[model samples]
Target: MTFEIAFVLLSLLGMVIALILDKMRPGMVLFSVVVLFLCAGILTPKEMLEGFSNKGMITVAMLFLVSEGVRQSGALGQVIKKLLPEGKTTVFKAQFRMLPSIAFISAFLNNTPVVVIFAPIIKRWAQSVHLPATKFLIPLSYVTILGGICTLIGTSTNLVVHGMILEAGYEGFTMFELGKVGIFIAIAGIIYLFLFSKKLLPDARPDTAVPDEEVEDGEKLHRVEAVLGARFPGINKTLADFNFQRHYGAEVKEIKTRNGQRFVTNLNQIVLREGDTLVVMADDTFIPTWGESSVFMMLANGKDTEPVPGKKKRWFALILLILMIVGATVGELPVTKEMFPNIKLDMFFFVCVTTIIMAWTKIFPARKYTKYISWDILITIACAFAISKAMVNSGVADGVAHYIIGLSHNYGPHVLLAILFVITNLFTELITNNAAAALAFPLALALSQQLGVDPTPFFVVICMAASASFSTPIGYQTNLIVQGIGNYKFMDFVRIGLPLNIITFLISVFLIPLIWPF
Candidate 1:
């Protein structure tokens, strides 16, 4: 074993342990590993920090602002209201009418905002139509995830993989290149939900429905949901033992586990886990005080998450988004290249222009633009690039790839591709999709090189696998968002999502290679 290989192995082991121990953010863990490599003379200062300035990373940052603009503009809400058929009265009919449209819209928009805007609307509408909201909510999240895989910018994971591709000196994905296989997955997923979902999905999660009573002034009681993080020192203790109300000045109504199990009536019996989410009723000050606290991994209340844009501004924001998509798509054409030989036109150019215009127009409170960006995610992605490089530099990626090839030699690249898909999907389920893609990309590239085949199929599989997270609410952000709002149980996700996961696996393994010709 060479010194570089040994050092890389130790660094990877330490990272896994640190992440599993839940002590540090992924960015911090990866950055610390890079520091070790730098100190040991394994990598130079420039190479170690190059990811911070990476074009793909910066593009992701810019897209955050762009998505924020659309979210705040209220265009998504208007579109959903218009698109949902007025006469749909049953869960099955409503799903048939809505899921495909949601999937199509989600292919063009960010999944979180789409879920945030649509989840409440769907729940209210389901109640009005005498349907089970639990039926449509999980499908809402699942379809958005499926739709997001169709476009390069649909999920941050896609862009992260694209960034890795560019960093590895490969051609990056085009605007709709992923649609080739992604559309099939989305269509199949929608069919599955339409046919089999009503039987499997839960009818209700206890205490998920909002309380009906309002104040004399017609204002709703402020109900906030928060998850305990490192800041709260009361892990593994009951609420009675911990004195919940005295410390936080809030009344805990229910506790939702990470897997979506809810303890609605018993607040004192169940012990608290660090990531356990408590649905509490408190005054308006709860969000203001604990919003930025490290004690809460998440703090969410309704309606105040983003400001609603007026009708005119909403239309303007929608137009800006459409132009960005169109410009980016058209810019990739040969005719456009011929027309503008000296200048470049791509998704990056359009996204940059859109973000700047939205900021200037104050589409989403330009003064606090940085607040909208998830700094933790950006940091994680930047560091992930460096970590992938370290693996390649130390030969760790190639070594692992060869071992897998040695074991699966008889079945050839098809088996290796399937293994990659399964591994990447499991990682996405356990960690963030962007992190999963980053960790899997280096090995995928190494495996392709070993087999002397096109890496396109491998890259496509990674893109699909990382975004195909199901079977758990924690797997995807959209799933988590809907889980709380819909009052879902853990088994609800497992029953419906497990089938979808299997479907995604089969389609990706069989369909991706056909399109990319590995």
Candidate 2:
């Protein structure tokens, strides 16, 4: 009822709108909120900037680098090629084999990279075997998410939460601590995908085995092709300069340079050049306009070709990635810890070293490899920490926690634990997993203080629930990656994921108290 409270609520509402619209990136949205609060004198400058220094933020950045190293080393690609079946396998057997393996790999590697490396391969294999790619992609993304919950270093979400816990003066999670619930969740998930997924999953598009080269044939939108001519005013200009929506009312889907560089059209700063091919989605009205423009040499009707990394670069990238994983594991051991107390062998350290080494080795030509890293994701994570700090410092999280405990007063600890698991899981589905953990963490601490019990079990629940992002594709980056490549509709994920979500929720509720003992 207080005006200040109302303002904070309004600010949070703004954040929700931003997330739903998704027109602006999450980082920009969170950052805008921070600035609004700061201007309102709700948060100090120190508080606004504090997230930048948080261990959680740093760990996420490091994980991205480590993932890049693995990607550059070509380790993931090789593994996918080896593990994926070639032909003549039953759909059930293939799903069982592929989902679990991908899940396990995602436990250590970044889930996004795992999906990216495997998506095309799975698509190709699905075509060759006369199976639907849609059937497997959602399962692939879901299983990886399930597997990421299994280890301390499995996903950046865990590390971020662990770092936040350490900052709260509690000892952070140990390696495999989450495995208590995570393993069961993974098992349950694998079971759901293996047994019921085929029945529930939609085969929206038949297995046409459209080669990466032939993705154009399946294009549903109106296609406009523009050839870059020498006098093209747009040449060397970024897409932003073209004012694409203003000038053509058409969205650029893909850009292909003469050199074979190809990518989704959202890349804003890529300079347009002569003799380049642009795959644009527009109405027929714009085609004549595009033809009249001097910027383009000609218009064509076809899908853009997929860019293939060099064979030598792919192999080297794979080897280097394997080395990063092995090295990070070795570096994190008790012996290694004792040898170098000052140097922590965490995701950040591993990623930094691996990125540097991969760049030096020119595994994927360091320059291009650098571009592969999702800078937006890193910024989003850092801003998420700031928002979390704001929530805690503003006493909002504690107030929410008090309200929750008041409601659960007569419900007992088991009921309270289940409630916490459900709340965390729902939050994770709505927001970034790391953001979910950050928001829930302060509540966990507050609840423990009120209940006069150990906070370990509560923290464990948050970690497990935060990483259980199975209900929606948009909730997790890996899911989005697979959704596009697998050509799956939104409901395909929910059909298979809803059961796995329930399974994980039940498993976490039962196991947390027994394992960590609140």
lDDT of 1 by residue, 234-295 (tens): 77678989988898887788888766678888779988865577888777677777764556
The 10-residue segment of model 2 with minimum total lDDT is 206-215
TM-score of each: 0.89, 0.78
Best by TM-score: 1
lDDT score, candidate 1, position 68: 78
Query: Over the stretch 92-170, how does candidate 2's per-residue lDDT look in tens digits?
Result: 9888678778888888777866775677677777777888877887787788888899987788778877777777788
Tell how far residue 437 is off in model 1, in angstroms: 1.1
Off by over 4 Å in 1: 85-88, 208-249, 264-277, 283-307
* C-alpha RMSD of each candidate structure in angstroms: 3.5, 8.7
Q: Best candidate per lDDT, number?
A: 1
